[model samples]
Target: MVVSTRAGAERSQNITVVRQAPPMSRTVSAAGLGAVGGMVTEYLFDPELGRSRRARLRDKGVRLTHGVRNGTRTVVRDVRNRGQGVLGAARYRTTGREADDEVLHERVRAELGRHVRHPREVDVRVESGHVTLTGDVLDRESRRAHRAVARIPGVAGVDASWTTHHDARRAPRSREDGGPMEALQDLFRQRWSPAGRSLTGLAAAVVWSLSGRLPRPLGYLVRAGCAVLAARAATNLPLRRLTGIGAGRDAIDVGDSISVAAPAEEVWPVLSDYGLFARWMPDVLDVRRSDDGGRSQWRVSGPAGVPIRFEAVETAREEGRRIAWKTTEGQLVAHSGELSVTPEDAGRSRIQVRLTYNPAFGAVGHAVAKIFGADPGRKFAKDLMRLKSLIETRRAPVGAGAGPRE
Candidate 1:
């Protein structure tokens, strides 16, 4: 007779088989035992939860042939189609010593683009992951370029010694960042311009008159104010190109947009993961979140590995849509940025990031920052590309075990 028995929702169930026949008889008469088992065995099965195939086996049970169990290992395997063996081994090989020439070339090109003003002018040749950079480039660019190439994941070595900086290849002198004096001169020259020269003259006359009429202390303040305003106005005017200064502007603005073949939900988690930002963002040495997790501080390496530190807070956010941040405190550089995610048809998303920052020392600091690939626009674009590659490819995290596949 069947005793009390019940099954869980799991496709498989715990079962107990009680032995009554003699052990000798059971061993010697397999066919006879099978005949008796067919008439005595009972199963308790539940169909509501058929997702799992594992079950526990217990003792202390009688059998009745009235019920059925529908669990099977093959069914679960078919549903998920999981793979076995070295997980991510192929990906690891592709990113390391076993990387092919094409992979190495791509990495080299991307790196060169970030540091060199004219990447197309450089000749990049990669064989067995050894890189040879040959082209006419600036002296400073050549040094920076070689160092950057050496740091790529698969580059065995860099050969750029033959690279020369010719006068012809040298950017025009006008493209150089004139010092503070030159910037002041550019603003003074604008006093004769047709558009705003009248207003400029009027403002100067007002400042001069006010300075004489005001008391000594207030007069000094008026003159100082006039000087500061005049300097700012000059820096804003279109002046000769300053070497290393982008767009002749004191502040840097960078923007980029990319299409990712993943849903917004899938991309948001990776974007908000501040700890891993350093992994995809170049030059970031370390990043930490505050105790409340609302603020983040970043330690970054600048040219020649000089340390630059900054703290930022998330200013605004929308779930699965966008995030905006600004530096609350920093050394050498101050920055603000935003990232937006938009859903398109299918399971694709368009992701965009924009960043703007000004150096603490103005034009000089801006020029020095370019030496380290610290340009906000250039950094933004490269970081976005890295992010795109990581998310779309779904590669395993850097140090995950090969035994388990996620």
Candidate 2:
């Protein structure tokens, strides 16, 4: 009796322990969520660029909200249009009144293109709702053309006088002739095409559902695939372009233009003097040009006072007009820049600068830099403003300091 009682007690204890296991899982999940939240907070509230990053996040949120609203409206409109088309089709079938001969001819002609391989070769004529088709057509295509014309809302009869050839090679080819893959590619490229929408929607749904059910690395991969499909559906950009691959991936371009009060000739000296770039260019600490003036080395201050160094060769030069340079091969970061000065009215000049840089990590590095307030585009705009002030006022701007320019 005692042994039986002890065994019963142990069994109850085991049951209680098993029942408690789920809470531990719940606790671990909560901790993971807390860690994620802490990391996000640290990222957005960094000491140096927190305010700007937060502002950017807020702006992006607003834009995303607007996009969602607009997308909803578009979907609703599409559904309404489809419903109207169905109703119109039904109404046309139910009506008994005979359509005019000219109207019936236009309808048959319109329907013929969808069914026939070579619509232009087939001539169409309609008299009292009777459609007459006369042309050289393939034997495989003639029956379909007759049936399609006869099915039109007001088509009474179809008279096919076409010379049917058994061999398709001898018949006239269609303007849209292509292989199956070509057709699919064309359909996928369209932003809001039915096929594209259906495929992306199905893919997104399947992957999203599987992402939660899958485990660890597999789940992560599925989530990434879902994101890529969603983005492709929204933007209609090719995978190569979206992922920053292929030929143009080496050139991430940013540009800005500013007007200066001085003449083009005066501005030319300020721009052409590579040695004095540190004075007006933000973050540039030193510039050293080769004896031939065809090559130059630059030292720039990066985020957290990290030193960035690169060598560039002068690719193009036109006196008082334009200067272009590109980084030497085998560099970690590929960089190229162009500056142009154009004469404007009232003795003014317009200076335009274009810079292209492909970082070591591609688009992801660029995005991270932008988020941390290290965007070269914004820096160049500030540099242009400082240069404009220095040239027009004949001295440094009000808050110019000895350290690297902000």
RMSD of each: 33.9, 8.5
- Model 1 residue 71 CA deviation (Å) reads 76
User: What is the Cα-based lDDT of residue 45 in candidate 1?
Assistant: 35
Query: In model 1, how many backbone clashes occur?
Result: 7
lDDT of predicted model 2: 0.76
Query: lDDT by residue for model 1 over 162-275, one digit each (tens)?
Result: 455644336442123321111233245523332233345458658867789889998988887776455444344332222223432225566789999899999888877777
Clashing pairs in 2: none
Q: Lowest-scoring 10 consecutive residues by lDDT in candidate 1? A: 60-69
lDDT of 2 at 204: 94
Q: By TM-score, who's the top model here?
A: 2
TM-score per prediction, in order, is 0.37, 0.56
State how far residue 214 of model 1 sits from its true place (Å). 30
How do the residues 329-359 of candidate 2 rate in per-residue lDDT, one tens digit apiece?
Answer: 8655567889899999999999999887765
